[model samples]
Target: MAIKIYGSFRSPFVMAVALAVYEKEQEFELLMMNIKSPEYMNNFNPFGKIPSYQDEDITLFESRAIMRYVATKFEGQGAPLLGSTFSEQALCNQWLEVNGHSFTPAIVEMAFSKADTESSKLAFEKFEKVLDVYEARLSVSKYLAGDSYTLADLAHTPLFHIFMAVSDDEKKKCLTSRPHLHAWIQDISSRPAWKKVTERPENTFYKPRTESQ
Candidate 1:
């Protein structure tokens, strides 16, 4: 059976999972579900989340978990997303945690809040600190988990895409100011799999905007 991903590209979680599938050289059916419907709740995700994964073997929720499963299940097929070495694997997991606990919150706040507002200022402060951390780490390493691209880096791509789409030049200075971090974003965002994701019709809604636009 073809893998079915329940949600739309509007949800970064859904896009992340789709990117993982593509990284593994797999195809999936993008789908929508009435998340609150009993059929969806019982069969897909009890919590009624936007992205739920269904394959021949199992059905799963939680985007990170789905990405991990895809990376592991399709290992050796395409890009080796789950780190090739034990150390890389450990670091991959560590950075994945950082994406969840530290990075996501700050980026979410920055993306959604009104510019120049008190909340936006606080978010920028927090986000800049996090970007500083990334800049330092990426300065030394080519990729988050080492030289090889891993789920750690993949997890961050969609959020950055959305940030770029909605942010103005002044706001984007947070990302573009950090040389290494900016380079890393460019590298990841340039991947062919991500290109396909962005080119999909569903992604039209989040098309990146420049200050002049």
Candidate 2:
């Protein structure tokens, strides 16, 4: 079978994985399963989470793992998913860990807090601190991994897209507050492939809400 991706567009993690596939000039079928359902839990990912990838060679779960798989498999076809230099590659891994273990959680909490009576203020405060680190690093480098955009930078694209769309106020938070980070965000967000990915008819994720975003 063709590469089959299991998950909904509702997840930024899922969207990032999809973006990685597209960046590699490949297509995949988007399959959303009720993660808690027996079939999904048992046959796909026993952990009952979204975003599993399958093809003739093997099956995979976790967005980062899936992205890595695509990067390794299609290395010759598209954007250098992994960095060219050893140091850049190491930074790529470090930043991806930040995307997973640090930055995304606070930012996601800030997003989900919109749906419930949660501590959005605290989340925002925490997110700002994270952004501060990004601003510092970006002031020195053009992309997260180095001079060229890598998987680490691509991983956060969907996130910054949503953050830009929540509201004008939120969008400004992404730009007006952090000059270096904002510039890097704007640069990466301007990719033609990213525009195409968002415009895909099958997309069911959050829509852009800003006039310029």
Candidate 3:
């Protein structure tokens, strides 16, 4: 059987996993799991999360871990996740953690608020602070892991993609206010594999560009 990615497009975490698989020249069967179902909770993710990866070698949860595993297991096939030098690898790990801890939450909160789910100004303020840190770090390096594109950079792609599509102003905020962050997002978003993902038939939840209408 092919590699199975259990989740839906609604979950950016799952989309990140799908991005990684394609970046590495591999395809996966995206299986949406009923997060409430016993089978999903028992066999895929104990946390009952949307994204759970399963392959012949192992079963995994946690998007970051799964991305790391895929990169190492299939290192030479696609974009290097570990980095070229020891310091680069360290920086990669640093940014990946930063992505998980600092970026994801704020982005999620802000997006939900944009949808009128609840208040999110506090989340937006928090995200601005997080972007400050990113701006500082990215000022020097071309990519998150110094000169190379790593899983670190790949990890944050999907969330920003969705966020940008929702609002042109938000897209401008995410990409332009900070010089390096903007460049990095553009670079990753332009990749062919990622383009393929956005084009998939099953991907129904599209937030169109403001100019589309």
Candidate 4:
């Protein structure tokens, strides 16, 4: 059976999973549903999350897990996303954890929150700290897990896209001021797989915000 991903591209998590599938040189059907519907809750994600994945061998929820599965299942086909060496693999998992638990929370807050409020200010402060960690790591390495572009690098593409789209100049500087981090962002976002993901029709929801808007 063809793989089916139950979600919308508006969700970065969904986009990340889709990017992973593309990186593995596989195609999937993007399906949508009322996530709160009983069928979705029961069969897809009980939590009613946007991205749930299904393939011939399994049904899964959670975008990161789905990405891992796709990377491993099709490991030989496309870009080697899981890392080429034991140290690289270990570092890949480590950075992926940081991306999920630390970086995502800070950036998501800053991206969606109204600027200039005390809360937004605090969020930016936190996000900069997270960016600093990335900058430091990236200063010495071309990719997050090393020279190889792994899932650690892939996971951040959609999040950074949304961040850059919505962030004001000050907030944007947290990323841009760091030369290495900015360059790394450019590198990862430039991949053919990520380009394909962004060019998809379902990607309409997160267009870059204009000043007039």
Name the best candidate (by TM-score).
1
lDDT of each: 0.92, 0.84, 0.83, 0.89
What's model 2's lDDT at 202?
Answer: 74
Give the candidates in order of TM-score, highest first: 1, 4, 2, 3
Q: What is the per-residue lDDT of model 3 for residues 1-213, given as tens digits with 9 covering 90 to 100? A: 689999888778888889889989988998886887898888888788878999998999999999988988898997776899999899889989988987888877776675433366676777888888888878987888888888898998888887677766644565577888888788888998889888877677866576521
How well does each candidate superpose onto the true structure, as a TM-score? 0.96, 0.92, 0.91, 0.95
Off by over 4 Å in 3: 114-119
lDDT of 4 by residue, 1-213 (tens): 999999988899999999999998899999999999999999999998889999999999988888899999998999999999999999999998998899898888877778679998888788888888998899899999998999999999999988778767765777778999999888898899999998998789777767421
Better of 1 and 3 by TM-score: 1
RMSD (CA, angstroms), candidate 3: 2.4
User: Which stretch of 10 consecutive residues in model 1 shows the poorest summed lDDT?
Assistant: 204-213
**Count of residue pairs whose backbone atoms collide, per candidate:** 0, 0, 0, 0
**TM-score, candidate number 1:** 0.96
Order the candidates by lDDT, highest first: 1, 4, 2, 3
Question: Residue 112 of model 4: what lDDT?
Answer: 70
Per-residue lDDT, model 1, residue 15, is 95
Candidate 2: tens digits of C-alpha lDDT, residues 1-213: 888889887778888888898889888888877889998888889999878999889888989988988988999988987998999999999999999999999888877775434477777778888999999999999999898888999999988887887657644665667889888888888886687778877775677764764
Answer with 1 or 4, whichever has the higher TM-score.
Answer: 1
